[model samples]
Target: LIWAAIHRIESGLNDFESQDIIVGTLGLLFGLIIANLIGLAFARLPIIGAYGPIVFSIVFGYAGMSIAIRKKSEIIALAGNLRLGKSGKDHGSKHKDMEFSGKLLDTSAIIDGRIAEICSTGFLEGPLLVPVFVLEELQLIADSSDLLKRNKGRRGLDILKQMQEDNYIEVRIINDDFDDVQGVDSKLVRLGRKINAKVVTNDYNLNKVAALQGVAVLNINDLANALKPARIPGEHMNVLIVKAGKEENQGVAYLDDGTMIVVEDGQKYIGSTVPVTVTSVLQTSAGRMIFVKIANE
Candidate 1:
């Protein structure tokens, strides 16, 4: 019966991939070594010395094997590092050379379309991966009955095509998907975890969710906000008053890049272009606002 049970256990282990077995074996060996060292330290304890090593060996060996199986990738990476050290290669430099392992583009970011311009600037590095599911989502939007969503979806497709044509960057449409996962954002987070990549998105909720899951997110909106021209009081610029603001005699204009400018006592100039002096600039989490008045008013 004992021999039959042992054979069954061996057969069950065959279900695990080779890497898992190797990592588990290494962990068990490491645990045994640690247990032996601890046991030797307790050798002077007259009562505990006799049984301590055997108990520690069994407990720690099982614990280590379980942990190693669960964290096989980490153990593999650690082993790779040791190999690189022995070969005298600077493994740290390899990581430094990469801006990111990979960048997975989400639907919102693709629709926002600034990612194409950002990539064209040669600032973003590494492969840009667009999952098949994200493409399907875009197609769904393109086929939507709503005009706005259709246009946005088509625009995203165009941006993606442009990025693919750029020779300086690598854009890959990945087929890897998780049907078991529900939302696109959740699938994106899962894919990022699997590939150890960062998610590029313009979604606030996805950003928060990915952060909670310890996934890196490159928010395109945050990038745009960061890249906006910095303005201060006394700066003068031309703006066209597009509409009236909340305050009396206030006109609202927008910069070419969409920074809102509130003009003081200039409601009369609605629908007209005029020069305005920056009175103050308020930087908020939502966006940047410039308060201004007609120059020389």
Candidate 2:
């Protein structure tokens, strides 16, 4: 209205674009700017100015009330959603009762690095979850000063790339993060608990922590343990001892499965395949350690 009134006043003059007209236009614009600022200032005052405060309070108050009401309603809805009968927690509990086939791979598992071969073997079933934090850790390792760590990180990335390319494995980069958790291992445990998924890792400390939390963990070492070929005591096998063990006349040979075989009185059999009888097998948390004795050449 102010602009219209100003325009009307200007229109009454014949010379619209002359110096006099330009001066009037500038004066009107400056008046509008000053008036708007004054109106804003008056609107902020407790009980001053005409109409500005009352109008502003009514408009803003109604808007704020509507927003507050809506927020209250949303909070009620969310509370309802959190109930036992209708909660996401109940749904998750139901899922927990069922067999979860999915696996969450940790950064260490990927870097300790047998996952690619394990996946290639076609035995690792279900989707593989690589959390966003795990990826960040891998990237950090790839940027590390240690050559071994850098190589491991690059290898992990390469394995993921190959898995994606081959379509032999399913991959999901989960974006969930636990702000309260300080480390990726803890976040992984929380994620596994939340989703009722199994964690695949090769870290000994992580395995212990997961067990303590009662979360299911598929330790690569344990998998390797279960996958090792069963060797019975007194069973005969051929091995080539490469080095002497710490004990006297104890020769050490490694099997195809990376199982260390300790042979008694077989130091002369070093670098040569010789028949040996398995005397005993020690099954530890990590894997099997076979103690053998040379029975014949």
Candidate 3:
């Protein structure tokens, strides 16, 4: 203890040459000195002087011992939990395919609502993965003050619960978290790459980013477009003009399938259902847009 004190003072004297080392060494020495000084001052007091050091030492000794034991136990518990998780993963591989055909569901997919229908039909094969972070985000939305956001969050939870009950669907919650990631979309892409699973999302930007990274994406919008009924020019169909379109004299209607139908000169037919002939169809990466002209009523 005396040797340590001398060494610390020597380092402090040569502070400029070894500033950080001196500061750290001196800080320890200063604490020890202050403690010893306090003990000495207590000893100088009347009747308590004889038992001062003993009582103080005993009190601090037990506290230090308890803290040491708690820290050691925590380390052991952490190691054991890690070992158990690894063992479960090893054992679980025997039943499920080691090469997971799992689908990593993104935030948009959960909110889109069509995934529930698709899952009901058994099209989405393999386990559906919902990251722990994504679940937390959904919970936040559910608790949000905004009515629409709260409803969306509640709907997501409902869908999750429905999936859990369906024997055809296997839902897996991945506890992986990327602290460096800000948005859920980026994290979804990162997770998809790590797990070698396809991403199911309705987010257009996420779809594009995943594709650039060579991560397989199962976009709901793409699926919807593919399943949408093909409409040829001159085909007659009745549609409800819900609103006016971007162009003059054009109105917009949506099929039960949610495909937008732009009816020319159907602006006047807004808020009414009318028969229309398909004039043209525009298919974009976004989705299919149909142009039509209301048939002379």
Highest lDDT model number: 1
User: lDDT tens digits, residues 1-297, model 2?
Assistant: 999999987677664324334444444454455555667888656566777745655555455444433233233233443453355464666632443566889998887768878887898896787888899999998998999989988988887878778777877665567788999999999878766678999888899899899788888898889878899987988999999999998899999978999999878779989989998999865678999998763
TM-score of each: 0.61, 0.64, 0.63
- The digit string of per-residue lDDT tens for model 3 on 1-297 reads 999999997886674323234333444454445556667988878877877766655555455444433233233334455665677776874534233477889877887788888988988896788888899989999999999999999999998888788766877676667899998888888877776678988888888999999899898988889888899998998999999889898899998877888888888989998988998999865889899887885
Clashes of 3: 0
Q: Is 1 or 3 the stronger prediction by lDDT? A: 1
Q: Lowest summed-lDDT stretch of 10 residues in model 2?
A: 69-78
- Please tell me which predicted candidate would have the highest TM-score against the true structure: 2
Assess each prediction's global lDDT (C-alpha) against the native.
Answer: 0.84, 0.76, 0.77
Clashes of 2: 0
Q: Output the lDDT of residue 194, model 2.
A: 68
Error of 2 at 83 (Å): 17
Decoy 2 TM-score against native: 0.64
| Candidates arranged by lDDT, highest first | 1, 3, 2
